[model samples]
Target: MSQEKLEKIEKAGFVLKPDSPEIRPNYERVREAFESRGIEVLLAERSARMIGEKGMPFERMCVESDFLVSLGGDGTLLSLVRRSYAWHKPVLGINAGNLGFLADVTIEEVETFLDQLFSGEYRIDHRLMIAGHIRKASGAKIEFFALNDVVISSPVTSKMVIVNAAIDGERFNSYRGDGLIISTPTGSTAYNLAAGGPVVYPLTKAFILTPVLAHSLTNQRPLVVPADFRIELDTEKYEAVATIDGQERYDLEEGDVVTIGGAKEGARLLHRKERNYFSVLRDKLHWGERNW
Candidate 1:
């Protein structure tokens, strides 16, 4: 109720993925809490569609908001982070699914978390992002950004693709598989982890290269590279598709190239309290824990 407390957060925005019927009650609870603190709340298009309410565009939600809340799992946060990266807004992820890395805050803790937020008890964790582009054989190009990873895969077409990767114009590897994952440190925990890639520290400045169902047995392991390196993947055997943050996709043909690099700006994430990295791994992933 204090003036300073009210001033701590002026304008807030929420983006809810899936926009399901079950999430409405919890959404109202969080909205009322924000309004009680004198914070102006905005909803994204998906959230707007559910309540017969009009919401601002996703890009405007990023630019206009003092802070943004993501209500869903990690995938939802990834979508939010990618869209909000240009505005460099801080995001708080209210996990609506299983245990998540970025969406660490639980729905049950939203009330307490807001109190901690207003009290200056939270810390901001900045995570790196990756930008990529696809250049067709005809010279046309399209660009995209991803907070998690850029995946080049043959998820369709009923055939595996041969993808050749290069680093800074030098040939790196000739991989024949479903595809390859070029992930930021934040994304190292997502598809990258499932593909046998290393679990990089979220704060690290690095990119991970992990092959998906690689055909060759030798010398086909995941590689970690410095952030400064530029990576390119070109396919010439079968059709491939470039997917950004699992949201956007582009078809890739023979001789098409996709270039990836560290983005100019990173994502700023808000966490209510300090959490140990190793402990998070143990709790979220059951890392280093034995069932026996």
Candidate 2:
């Protein structure tokens, strides 16, 4: 990052979830590595005793730290990003699980990356996020922020849902499907892609709406709109749920309306300067491999 764009980082926030015994020792080793460089590091939340002392909660740690390091899979990093986006904290992902799409770094490589991190050999990717506001029939209001995607589906796994979606208050499309996905460019490869949505470039500023298993409306494909477009979703008939990043879920009764749009703040993902989106995609997906 350029000098002006980079914030002075002294204390690093660690987001380690589940507090497992096997990962504890590695966590301590990483913490010691950070502290050795005169950078104070704290766990984002309390952990297993094997990792030693309990660190502060996520909110406190985020506010106190110069930046954050997520030690888990993509799901864990997404949760951390959603909570810490308000602080605009740049987050580094250390993959401790399988198929870490967002958590792109391995535990073994983080030490080397830390040296480059403090030496100004990194870049910050400002990825856009989405916000979902729900107005229930009982006058209750709920709001959520998601770094990946917000999904709405039927309570029963086998049942299909009737969803009416409008863009900017204009009539758009209605679907009879299992669910719908409102994703950001950063989330194009998530549920959106699984449901046949286009794979948008991570840097693109757009909103993608993809319906899951639409009935009758075979033409109801994923819709990509400008980031500023306001999307309204009305679920009728079946009991449904609004799922945020697959972590937080809220039950939606009949007649509930959900408003989704671009969040005021986006997640800041930190990466080594040499890391390229296409290169990562190719390496992870085996794009150039031959079919023997």
Candidate 3:
């Protein structure tokens, strides 16, 4: 941590989810408490629809603030990260979901957490992101960014497609499956986990490739690769689509080459004093021995 970074966080911003009924009151209470103590708050306008309550006026808030605190589940936290692409604000998540690998605090700890935050007792971890480029044979291309996995699959399409996987210009494998997933370390616990990929920790600098419902059982397990290596997907079938963090999607044509790799930018995630990766995993995954 640079001194400049530390100073940047001393004056923090806040982004809250206003849609979750269970989370709305807590958000308001936390906001009031923090504001009463002289902390700056920046609320996301979309929260109004999400919480079924009128959110803070967007015009009154400035996007370029210090750091941002996200009040919701992992999904809500991801939304803040995406919205902060240009702002590049550090984000802290408060867990309101069943499993909150990304969300670090609980609603009950908001005030104390804020106190510790102002006291400079917390740390920020830089989490890697995936950069995806959609290329068309006609010289048109669109590039996007994500803090989670990039999925290219049929999901519910009527037919299976073949995708040739390449890493750093070398052929890796050919997959005959419903789709393929290229996930960041932060995403290993998300859709990648449900698809049977390993739960990579925050410190890992790697990307994961998991095949979705491959036609063959022999090559179904997920593979992890170095973060900087360029990954390409060559498909022989049309109608394939690519999604970023399940928030954005695009269509893929036959022979379209999609490249994915570590993003130049990343999310600055904040963690509380009592929070650690192993602790979160143990609680979220129920990793301890069973009481048989």
Best-fitting candidate, scored by lDDT: 1
lDDT by residue (1-292, candidate 2, tens digit) is 3333456768888877664657876677778888888889877545534366776877888888888887777877898898787788888888886646678878787778888887878788878889779999888899889888889999788798888899999977888889999989888888898899998888788999888988763688788899888999988888899999889999998878999988876688887778778887777768898999
Give the Å error, residue 206, model 3. Answer: 0.5
**Could you tell me how far off, in angstroms, the CA of residue 190 lies in candidate 1 after the best superposition?**
1.0
Candidate 1: worst-modelled 10 consecutive residues by lDDT = 1-10
- For each candidate, give its TM-score against the true structure: 0.92, 0.94, 0.88
How well does candidate 3 score on lDDT at residue 45? 64
lDDT of 3: 0.77
Q: Each candidate's lDDT (Cα)?
A: 0.83, 0.82, 0.77
- The stretch of ten residues in a row with the least summed lDDT in candidate 3 is 1-10
Candidate 2 ranges with C-alpha deviation above 4 Å: 1-4, 48-52
Residue 68 of model 1, lDDT score = 91
Tens digit of per-residue lDDT, candidate 1, span 98-125? 7688888887888888788878877788
- Looking at model 1, residue 179 earns an lDDT score of 82
Q: Model 3: per-residue lDDT, tens digit, 170-209?
A: 9979888877888888898888988888989866889999
* True-structure RMSD for candidate 3: 2.8
Q: Cα lDDT for residue 292, model 3?
A: 100
